[model samples]
Target: MIPAEDRAEAGRPPARVRHRRVFYVPGYDPRSPRTYFLLFSRELRKFAALHGITARMRAGKEDPATSWHVTADWPGGPVKTTVDCLSWHEIAVRDFAVPKWRVALLSLRVLWDAVWTGTVWRMLRLNWKFGIFSLYPWGMALLYALAALGLVAACLTLAGAVGLPRLAGLAPAALGLYGLLRLTEILDRRFFVWYLINDWIFTWRHRTRRDPEADARFESFARRVADAAEDPSLDEVLVIGHSSGSFVSISIVARARELMREVEGRPRLALMTVGGNTPIAVAGRQPSPARAAMQALVTDGGMLWVDYFAPQDVLNFPWLEPVAAFRLDLGGKPPRNPSVRSARFREIFSEERYAEMAYRFYELHFQFLRANDRHGEYEFYRFLAGPEPLESVTREPG
Candidate 1:
């Protein structure tokens, strides 16, 4: 038999109790928190079985006030994890389903802003820098144009069917345009592009307008985070932000830190941003309140901030450093930047599955939250329920 000290450390029991509280903030999604609970439950079971670990996740009542608890029985000991999904879906739903005219106006406004602020040029530059043309949002504009053309062609076809010889000349155009638009819409939802543009507008308004309801919700979320941080039973408090939620999470955490100064004992706080699109939210607004909040979080040394990006995900800027890209001014010497790690979705899914979803932008963006087919350092379930701490787990990407 091998000597005790020579034995594998993985077989040894953990030195400290494992209790973590996680706050998950979703992106510009209109789904309820129940969606996340269901996703977690499904993914946790699959990952646990694959890793040969005894893990069980039971979702509590579908209420924003309550937490979903997960338990994992590992070689070291049992780990208790409580996750709270801070959902802003209500806001998203209100903004995304506007009338067709409003969508057109918003799309026009987005284009105007892109031109006025050189956002279009910046996007082109990014495409060249990354050597990936998909980084440009031109596909969204093309989809919009095709959708409008399809609607017009449908109207023209109906007119032609009613024996209008004048419109007969447009018949061939109608057939080709309608068929192409339908196929494109089938691949990527037609409204997604408009919804994304509207989300950016909403961010701009939230920063500029300072709406009372939005401010109230922001305060409420920050208070919830502060409550979690102050809980003595928790060893770690992690705030997870995905996509648009990345910028919102930054603001919430900055506000939470402000409120935490009043609390006597706060747990170790950590921030994890996956497939983040923060640069878009803060773009064209230098010296803005949103930028100030982001700067505060980046410079705050007490919290451990880790951001994960996948090169294949075209929605998020993989090479943009939040601090340098934003031109954040931290007083005196700058603190270490957030540990930005690269995650590989190609490794997470099978070759067949990856190839099937190669062009699905949203699916690739969300790969950060799914169950991984290959064992990697960035397993979503393991980060939420495993024995290891998030800080250590995210130190290096596999």
Candidate 2:
């Protein structure tokens, strides 16, 4: 009905897409981003059916094992996968009752993958630039030499104590050993912090650089999820963050918004933090620094932030309120009374509503990558689909 130029001027890109639901998952490894694809592929397939869009997911160029796939009616022929519904079913069953020895072996593989793919990847990417300093190599060499010296000195001290009349002389050697252990812990934390900052910088660079194709893909995914609802207006996009993933999502969302001018009328965004450690992203030794940039993005972007805390989750900050800060609890259980609001900034009042889904909480951070049906239901599926949409926006709260 419109002229060609007018129609073209209507938009830089078309608003509608082939699919109605699109989901993106974060990598389970704090240092690497492969786990997200492994867990969410099936759900992505289900979501594709809501709309007539074909989906195809593959590994990032860097990591392949943790990648996934989803499609509808695409030009490419269907992908051949060793994974199928039945395979996942058996894997799930075995994992539920996995033998101790097998689990131990699996844990070792996971550790190896994490160290090699996650840690080593960062080292190679030099994304953080921690070890890239002019003096960093020399400093590290010196530090290692000092550690060796300390080890030898303590051994000598122990040998000297062997001939002492009493065991009192051994105290110094024991103290030295204890000090060495403490120093290791301190170094570990520092190295982790250094790596985090570098990753953050890498992510930030991408956010600012502007990627139209990637943003279009995300917008397509968002619109798909929005269209799946009986009422598109009530379609709420909920982002659930686990462990270090909180950082990735928050950063992505913020970056997405900064690029909003490039794409107009994007979907409204809300966030739920489950066992999140986002603070560590900008966090230094201090409690909380001013991240007005991040805070402003969420605030202006119309984000309804709901943070879930399990008291038992030791990896995240316990006392900080999510709307304002972070909290650590045993699955971060919400109050029984649904009437009680979760926090000042949080829209969802109580955690009781999500209680049955509590097993998804990761007090044990590493459990995130482990295949579990509970996680499939509580964490991933819940986002893709939920109970029937309210007939009206004002429908009674359950």
TM-score per candidate, chains pooled = 0.81, 0.39
Candidate 2 local lDDT, 1-398, one digit each (tens): 11122211222221222222223334233423333454456545544444334544555344355323333343333322211110112222323344433433443443343344343333323223321321232345346448756776766766667775444545665676567645644774644322332333323322333334433444543343334222233333344455544544454444444444332444334444445544433332222212333454333413343444333444443333323332212234332110101111112213442354344333244333222322222233323333211111111221
Q: Highest lDDT: which candidate?
A: 1
Off by over 4 Å in 1: 1-17, 61-66, 126-191, 210-212, 262-265, 396-398
Worst 10 residues of 2 by lDDT: 336-345
Worst 10 residues of 1 by lDDT: 1-10
TM-score of 1: 0.81
Q: Could you give candidate 1's per-residue lDDT for residues 42-109 as a string of tens digits?
A: 98988988889888877766754446989989888898998988888887777756754576566566
